[model samples]
Target: MIQDYLRQQVESKDYQPVFYDLKNAQDLHTFEALLKSRPYIRINDEIYSQLRELMKIRNPTKRLTAAEYDEKVQAYLDGVEIEKFGVWVYYPWNNQVVHLVNEADFIELRTSRNQHKITAAEIAVLSKKKIGIVGLSVGQSIALTLVMERLCGELRLADFDRLELTNMNRIRCGVHNLQVPKVVIAAREIAELDPFIKVKIYEDGMTEANMDDFFTAGGVLDIFIEECDGVDIKILSRIKAKELKIPVVMEMNDRGMIDIERFDLEPERPLMHGLIPEVDIPTLRGLTDAEKLPIFSPMLALDNASARMKFSLGEIGKTITTWPQLASSVVLGGALVADTCRRIALDQFKNSGRYYVDFEQLIV
Candidate 1:
């Protein structure tokens, strides 16, 4: 039975897959031509009724005749060049072209209710900013949330780690993606979600050599998100960010702690709230688990950590293998970081400091 199921899954199908790099002008043109060749407009009954009502409103003094309504519908269809506009996304996984509406229409429809909350002008501001996220563990959630909200025009992702079965606990992915680089998995998912947004990948991860490039290489990032586990990177990234005058944001999945450093506003701000004052990159990299606890505990403020997390940290090299993180906490961290990034980018909030989205505190 299992063999039969496996066989069925791999069997070839009648549908031939088509792939295209929409980034290329020729490929995009080809996609547009294909869409035009077999033009399709699917309007449900409800939308048809709405269209009729809209036609009636065109002339309030006189009710629209059936023939006039039909003419208006036809004119509306004639005006729509379905092929000419829209972001054409070619998904290599399934080999399909997912056509999304053009930018203006897309933004307006997708964020219609967000008008009073985020304001149209604020959304336009977010669309121009570029954000870079290093580390795709907790960073995965942050990346997806940002894309869903249309927070930035482009994203830069860096992570040397691959998707292992162990990562499934926090990183949202399927079993088929095992061993694939985290950056590739994230980029592919982002493309499927919004291919119009540009994504640049740093597969090698952020290192001392490429630290400068990661922060300022492609385009000056409006915001930098740091969520990796490397202590060296934690320190080195901030140094570069401070020098480049870019704001930095980080989320600790435990206890829902968020750190926002607005180096762009205060270049003299200490890294990690002055927790690792005198430590250099090499020194931080060489510290052992026991040796590093003193520094980390202070920064995390272990006294304020959740009971489970505090206990888990005490068992690092003993019974427990590593620090504990939950999907719940990671998801919350994503939301927290997204909101912080949005507020910071929009210039609505100016104070830079430590923040907690602790469920323990909020639930009560």
Candidate 2:
């Protein structure tokens, strides 16, 4: 009976975090009531360490003795209203409550190491930009890196697939999460890593229904990342991106190949750099994976793919189930996409074209 209940309700369970402001008496009372109701709620209070690091960043010119540092820490702690110092985030799924410094101090302390390299001004600039990623297999790495660095103020995610056992080879997540939607996993991870970043989920994945809103609902995206498996969706996305003049970034996830189309820079630029002939979206749909390979190969740039990757592609129907990917390659693609997006968001990289970061070629 218990197993049946869990199987029925797990998919509909809420994954989003809830924030409570202890500064409000009503909220405080509710939180206290929650504490009484669930006495075993895990507590994670790390605001003191955050305050300590925040002090160092704020006073780079001042050298402090151990005693003085502690004194300063205590003084700051005493001055602020402890309850209002940060937020109490409750993760209902795990029955855990985490205390974190507010967005400003939290972001500053978390990304202090990126200073000068990212500059305080650049961080502010990045905080105002919005980024959308349509696939979460390899895009999972890209999204995580983006949140870790606080790259964008808002991140829009779209993925309709669920976490399968086979995805364990590349996508990082616990086995317990098997059968959960990929977007939920990505969103939950983002909420835990940095609550400051706004993550919008397209649970149905990228479809014509939500494409417009995905790009422009809250605000137009500064960058659009495409990583889904559907050939029709890929073509449609580029067409929409071209129409909106939004730049598109895609990583082939093999031999470190990445493509950047600056439709925002050159609106008239051909879709997929004119690599594939135009086709109607309805005709592209309803085709088998084998039938889609002709159009898919060109978009994936399979002609120049690594030799092993090419062989793996050929064995899809015989030996392997599909294109084989490694954790290493997916992570590498994540770094590549994140860096390119950051530079583009900051106007550091302007030209649009395909580029390679092939480790095999660069290492030797």
Best by TM-score: 2
Query: In candidate 1, what are the lDDT values of residues 21-84, reduced to their tens digit?
Result: 4556798788767667655522111334544554554455887789988888668546654343
* Model 2 misplaced regions, further than 4 Å: 1-12, 74-78, 81-84
Q: Over all chains combined, what TM-score does candidate 2 have?
A: 0.95
Local accuracy of candidate 2 as per-residue lDDT tens digits, 1-364: 9998878874554567888888888988998999999999999887777777777878899987778777887787777676567889998877899988878878788778998889999999999999999999889999998888889999999999999999989998899889899999999888888877888899999999999999899889999999988888888898889999999999989989899999999999999888866777799877766677788888778889999987887777787677888999899989999999999999999888889999999999
> To one decimal, what is the Cα RMSD in angstroms of model 2 from the true structure?
1.7
The local distance difference test score of each candidate is 0.77, 0.88
Highest-lDDT candidate: 2
TM of each candidate vs. truth: 0.79, 0.95
Clashing pairs in 2: none
Predicted structure 2: lDDT = 0.88
